[model samples]
Target chain A: MLPIATIVFREFLEIALIISLVMAATQGLQGRIKIIMLGLGIGFLGAAIIAFFTDTLAASVEGTGQDIFNAGVLFVAVGFLSWTVIWMKHHAKHLSQRIHKVGSEIVAGETSIWVLVTIVALASLREGAEIVLFTYGMMASGQVTWSDVFTGASLGAVGGTVVGVLLYLGLLRAARRHLFAVTSWLLVLLTAGMAAHGASYLIAAGVLPDLVPQMWNTSHLISGESLMGEILGVLIGYTPHPSGMEVLFYVTVVVLIALLMYRPWHSKAVVAQK
Target chain B: MRFSFPMLSLSLLLGMMTLAPMAGAEEPTYTLEIKDHTFSPETLTVPADTPWTLIIKNHDKTPEEFESTELSREKIIPGGGQVRIKMGALKTGTYPFMGEFNPDKAKGQVIVK
Candidate 1:
């Protein structure tokens, strides 16, 4: 039970951290917390359905369905998160300037909160489905009873959520006025890293090129599969040995988004209007 | 800008057609069977530092996800279905895999030595 708890906790931890981070980053939006919660509910439902259809889906595309499907999900998430970063870029100063007004609020661009919904949904779907599947497997094997599985899963879920809350509190403590700006920058990089990750899966499936395969091997120093590596991967896209193509994708996302956010033309004109 | 660069990279990949196709080169194969939610031969030993193919045959009535975080490989094996999984060359080590739907009993390891 404890072992299962540990494994399940790690899985839940990643999702929790991502959820809290995104939620915190979009702090000024009204009722986004509720929307995010709704997304989780929908995501879990989606996860179960997807898990049940794993067989049919896996058989597709010459047995590359799983990879392709996962890559698709990651890519969609990248799109959603990238949209948030860009939307936030147009409103950062507005949000900071209006931070002091507790009751009066001004959300620039008035972009749909659905972007956050989609991200939370994607994040929850993959991990939630995995946890359900893993727990089900353990129960079916009778190696552990249902009671043990339930106990472990509950503990792990709580432990992971607690960590997320802690991280959120830490970020919240960092000067309310600047928190939005700081985390939005983090969101942009995180989104880019996710794009690289999605492409890596496509490369593994032979649908995309690995290019230089291993740009460098740092697995000996910090294996991405390790617990810490997994956390960093979620937080900052830290893969010890990213392929050349992933590096290309990462760099491209950063450069492109940065340009879009600060096109001298766009910035100068917008500042003049302000 | 995002659209342009991805398109540009797509062209770059397509231009390197020769290198891309080589990824599917023939490799050694090993077979594993899952019955009653348990894997046979609980451990499989293979030569290290060589790409290999895994032919998994699932004989149950429900589908199973064959997943391995260590090898970063995953594929679905439908009930009474067979699928091939390819892994990249690796350093000597043990990489465990399992039926994601029946992990507790369906676990197995690839011993690369």
Candidate 2:
């Protein structure tokens, strides 16, 4: 078996390299020192907080506590995801507009390098934190090994780096611009699944007792402990036998997000300024 | 100026009167003990509607930290020493806790039974 420590180190190195590439692409060589430092600082801080919390939670809920923790985490994850989707729906367009505006300024100014650096730093920090948190959750779930996580993370970094480079070269600028939407939707899908899984955990704990708890049992199709199951679990929070709460959580999250998307409340502060 | 001075004095008096009850308020106490990598007496049964002062004693030689997810509370207790926890009325159910710094030999439970 591979050492978990080695795998984590490799993952960190991969992320660092990806950030470096993004820096090279967006900021060039003129003036990116401060922005680069800020990005690194944010990324590391986010990772450390996530790691510490995950470890603490894992240790606390070792035995039967595990089930409780899983359910609790699942519920909270669902709530958080619902909030995120609604928030994004309302603000993402505005955010992109602001970025384009800022991009124009950077392109026009002599201190353009500094602007580019800050943009790159902010973007990387946001995405980096998400990647790290999601990876940690995957690791804690026992659906995959440290090696699997490292592998996924490394691949993601490679993919993200290539996109960053192409973006800088102007070969795939449109695709880069499309990233925010794509990643946001991806996160929504991922969170919905996590919420369902969490409800399943709670169901097992009797906290959420349900009639006809087995919503079309799929263990015969894909056991929860199998590799395919793990993949499904990570991507869409798939469970073999979901209880009523699981279904309820998943459907609720979807509905709430859909509503928010229909009539989002854009920040009044921004609109008021306009 | 004279009117303003009297108003300020009256307000100060009212503020002191309001804080008198708070000044005499007591901190909640909780009792937690660690043994065998598990928190002995895992269910820390406390009053459902009242604040608690947790006094945790780590009898084991391993360093341990007591953490609860539902409560979102954590306090590190040095081996052979003790730590204190203060909590308000928490929702009914089992709140899980564990030794974070060392998970091996210092394990136990805290049941709010």
Candidate 3:
């Protein structure tokens, strides 16, 4: 039962962190909660379907299907997140000045809301499927009773959600005035992390090379299996020993997003005009 | 501003294409099997500083995730299914892996020497 709880907790925590970040980031937007909830619903449904098709998915693409599928999901999430971060940069000024007006306009405009939904959905889909598959395996194996599974799952779910809530509240309190800037930057890092994660999957699938295998090892200081490692991994793409390809993907996304957001070229052109 | 979206996607495509697949078919291959949630040949020995392919076959009636933090590789093997994971060249050491669904019962190690 304890093992079951631990596994569920680890998976749930990853999903919870992503959802909480999105929720906190879009705090001022009207109907954002409903949109996020809708995404969760869709994600749960998708997870069940994916879990059911595990065997087929595993066998596809000459047995590299699972890695390819995971990479696809991560890349899709990265795309949505990058779009949202850049979009927010353009509208944040209006969002701060007239919260109510811009909030409604954001929902009514539909693009940002859909992007939010897609991000939330993709975040939940991968982790949620893992949880579903794990619990189902436990039940099917008959090594654990139904009550044990239920109790453990509930405990894990509650524990993960409480942490997510704390994170959301903390972000709100800490960055009230600079909420947009803080969250946007956070999203940028999160997007980069997702890209690196996707690249890792591609490397695993043999679709890409690792370039150099182990850049450096910090597992002695912080094992990837440890709780701290997991949190930092999700939050900032911290890997104790990242592959060369993973580092490249992470750096590329960060540089790309930074360039797009700041647009140093625009400033240079303005200076030239002066 | 509008051009940025196209630029972003185009760059992504270009990046992917440039990093074309270079996984050699000549790399050494190893096999691991999972039965009753336990790894057969729980300790696999391989040459150090050499990349290899690990083919994991799960004969269980339920899915298992093959995870190795040291290797930085994780993949799910469905019931009665198998997966091929490309492992990087490693220095001499012991790298542990486990079936995440049954971590306590399904544990193994890779010894690179």
lDDT of 2 by residue, A64-117 (tens): 233354344344434444444455455556544666656534332333333333
Q: Model 3 TM-score? A: 0.92
Chain A: TM-score in each candidate? 0.91, 0.49, 0.92
What stretches of model 1 exceed 4 Å from their correct place?
A96-111, A144-146, A174-178, B1-29, B34-52, B59-70, B74-83, B89-113
- Measured against the true structure, the TM-scores of the candidates, in listed sequence, are 0.81, 0.40, 0.92
lDDT of each: 0.73, 0.47, 0.83
Cα-lDDT of candidate 1: 0.73
Query: B3-113, model 2: which lDDT tens digit per residue?
Result: 132244235434433332221136455566776446766666776655555666667554454644344344444446554343544445565555543434344444444
How would you class the docking of model 3? medium
In candidate 3, the residue pairs with backbone N, CA or C atoms under 3 Å apart (3 or more residues apart, or in different chains) clash, namely none
Clashes of each: 0, 28, 0
Cα TM-score of candidate 1:
0.81
Candidate 1 per-residue C-alpha lDDT over A137-255 given as tens digits, one digit per residue, 9 for 90 to 100: 55655668888988998999899889888888888897476887778777777888888887777776666766665677676788766778877888888887677888998898888
**TM-score of chain B in each prediction:** 0.78, 0.62, 0.83
Name the top lDDT candidate: 3
TM-score-superior candidate, 2 or 3: 3
Interface RMSD in Å per candidate, to 1 decimal? 5.2, 17.5, 3.3
Best by DockQ: 3
